[model samples]
Target: MMPLEPVVLSFGAVLLLGLGFGSGPCNIACLPYLGPVFVATGSGPRNAWRILLPFTAGRLTGYTLLGTGAGLLGLIVQEWIAAPWVRWLLGAATVVVALSLLWRRRHRGGGCVTDPASATPTRVAPPEIRMTNGVATGASPGATSGQAQALLPGGLFLMGAGMALNPCAPLTTVILAAATSGSASAGLLLGFGFGSGAVLVPTLVFALGVAHFGQQLTQHMNRWGSALEHASVGLLLLMGMGTALGWIAP
Candidate 1:
């Protein structure tokens, strides 16, 4: 078992780090994916709590699994590989991931566009929408019922997973390495803390607006969301490049 103190402290640090870094960019880039989840859950107090629970649960599961895997991998590397090589390899990998993100951004139109009326918007309609309507009759614009059903719980989970899977920095790997070398339980606990920290603020904001936030809510969210996505991509690219050049360690 992991020592309770270190595990708790590590978890707390990871959580705070995630919150500090994740709030602006992840929140913005992921709004479209999340908005429907909120909307589907009915945008009320009870629904917000219900969705938040499962969403947080899934996130916790993902992070714990990731941390555990990283911890195990670190153990293997520690046994077989030199520490310098590991750092270099991690740095190289970070750079590659960052470059990929940059290339994607360049090709995919530089993150999401904030303005709805702008040449491009951050969120686009899914390709499947092109197919002829089958399950439900096509309703007039601004209709809620059919749209709501389309944004089911399963769909929300998948989206959340996708959003979280984006290439992140060495934070998780570093934390896992520390914990696994010490204790597996500590690593898992730290993972939960990081996940919770990353999610707390947005979840709170979402909870607060469960009932109503008027038209401004959507508009403001869209604008900020786009900006956040752009920032995240840029940060990732810069960090990746720095790591690649040996200017920073993983």
Candidate 2:
């Protein structure tokens, strides 16, 4: 019988990584752009089902592709590097990243770039704002809001793809390694299971009350969005530290 340890470990790693990163500060930073898609669908049972199906489908595709790619890479790494050393190196790097985040949080206010225009005391026009065609007028071109909604199925697909492209979770890396260490096919299948387990609940929830949740979050917590961002960062740092210290292990 095949030893189940590798597959089980990969599953746990992927699940933790997904949950940690998905709910962390980085996600909050991206929320302003992502929130509208959820909220635009309106919190109806039917609409919820509709939105979730496509989103999950997109996410599943993304995770599968990522796993495939990672599995291939893992095979290369296994040939080139010793496994224990690789794990330690990754563990160390993860800790360093976490430390950097904490350091930035601590010393964030030191560097300040003041506008020269402010010193010159020029009169500034009140920022003109308007609404037209059910969209905010005078909105900056770079602004993203409900923009994802505009793209609908395509946009959601891209979002899922992007999420997998550069997953920040340490566990994700570990899972990819574990999966690839064995059969690439096994790794890919495990990746699918991990992504499925992690994403299922949130996608379902978002589908159910996307619109209501969007409105409530935007209207009430917009100002506090930064707070959410910081909280997420803290969570990621904590998770990274826990893993590094072996308080939590794959």
Candidate 3:
């Protein structure tokens, strides 16, 4: 068993690292993916927690797994993350998610058009409306079905976990320390502690700040709602490809 004191110090160091990075670099890293969802969904303060909480949990899960692997496999975990195939796999997953969202939107006939009279965004489709030229025949433009709604939480969770898998400078340093520690328990402790600190800033910013801003933007810019949604989807697609092709640095 390794000395407890070293593990304690390492844990503290990693926790501080997460806190330091969480506000800036870490937040930036998460924004590319999360931003689209926040803005596209028009997540407000009331529902932001619903999205952010699961994501935070997912990130913690990924970090814990990485730390445990680091302890168990020493430097092998680092090698695995750095592998080219891993990058391709992560990128592919992102691309798939983007496609899935697009498909759901089109298939569900959920277009988000503004009611010019009320300046309000509605997701409900009229019964009198029918399919035309392969357009959405069911839900209003941009609205998802109950099935899609059910999967949203899970998707958000996976998104958080996936983001955490992209190792950053601080996280990599912590992984190195954990790998050398030779104690799985110590590594897990450090990973979880670091994750705890890492999520703080994102929670405040994404769940509260971004959410409020996104809702306001959606409301004020109701006329451009469809364009915004389309743009977000396109952004996700580009990012997914960039990540997969090594054009984007994690």
Candidate 4:
């Protein structure tokens, strides 16, 4: 069996890049509006853990299934995947993600820069959540009030599942690289690692300080979010360049 550390390191870097600071579909930054719901319910910290755990679980479930399936396909044509040129291809891809972020910041003022990590997702929340008597609550078009609480888990899960929906080329590349290892389990392991990182940021945010520092946390995160984004991109560029230069080779 291949020593799995290098594979895991690659997946973690890519996953963090996607979730920690992005405007794309998989970025938890895209879901900042979620903080208010827990806050309004007066169970922000508790619910943050409960809902976010399952949200992360849903992501792992989807990624594992999809990655495992693709890995099986990859095994059928291992020669193609094993070609030395393939590593060069994957390395170039990592470089592209780094460059794309920089170019977007320079040219588009940080407009939506789609990458392989952006998943196709149905927006998790309703277009708008109606404040019911000062609390964030809502009902379906015809349903009675007080339904949001009953359905919050499902909503959170769906949102998390949405993260897995559109597999970007780069993400798919990562998965396929694992599949090329000739072990179907490699894809599953990588998926689990990636999904865990996806939830870690938002979970830590809501669980640690958001409950007590709702206004402050939001303000600070908003102010620091771009810096975090730029910082993560810089790290990504470094990670990619390191791989391209064989500095991170196993």
Clash count, one per candidate: 1, 5, 8, 1
| Cα lDDT computed for each candidate against the true fold | 0.46, 0.44, 0.70, 0.45
Clashing pairs in 3: 109-136, 110-140, 110-141, 110-142, 110-143, 111-140, 111-141, 111-142
Q: Hey, what RMSD does candidate 2 come out at?
A: 12.5
Best by TM-score: 3
Which sections of candidate 1 miss by over 4 Å?
1-9, 39-42, 75-151, 173-182, 214-250
| Candidate 4 residue-wise lDDT, 65-96, digit = tens | 65565456553333433344433433344444
Model 2, TM vs. native: 0.45
- Which pairs clash in model 1? 28-225
Query: Using Cα atoms with residue i matched to residue i, what is each candidate's TM-score against the true structure?
Result: 0.47, 0.45, 0.80, 0.44
Summing lDDT over every window of 10 consecutive residues in candidate 3, give the lowest-scoring window.
Answer: 124-133
Kindly report the root-mean-square deviation of model 1 from the true structure over all alpha carbons: 11.3
Could you tell me which 10 consecutive residues in candidate 2 have the lowest summed lDDT?
A: 123-132
What lDDT, from 0 to 1, does candidate 1 have? 0.46
Best candidate, lDDT-wise? 3
How do the residues 102-189 of candidate 1 rate in per-residue lDDT, one tens digit apiece?
A: 3423333322332343534323221112111222555332234334334433334433443443435534454545444555666666
Between candidates 3 and 4, the TM-score winner: 3
Q: Tens digits of per-residue lDDT for model 2 on 187-241?
A: 6765676666656556644554454564444334433433443554455455445
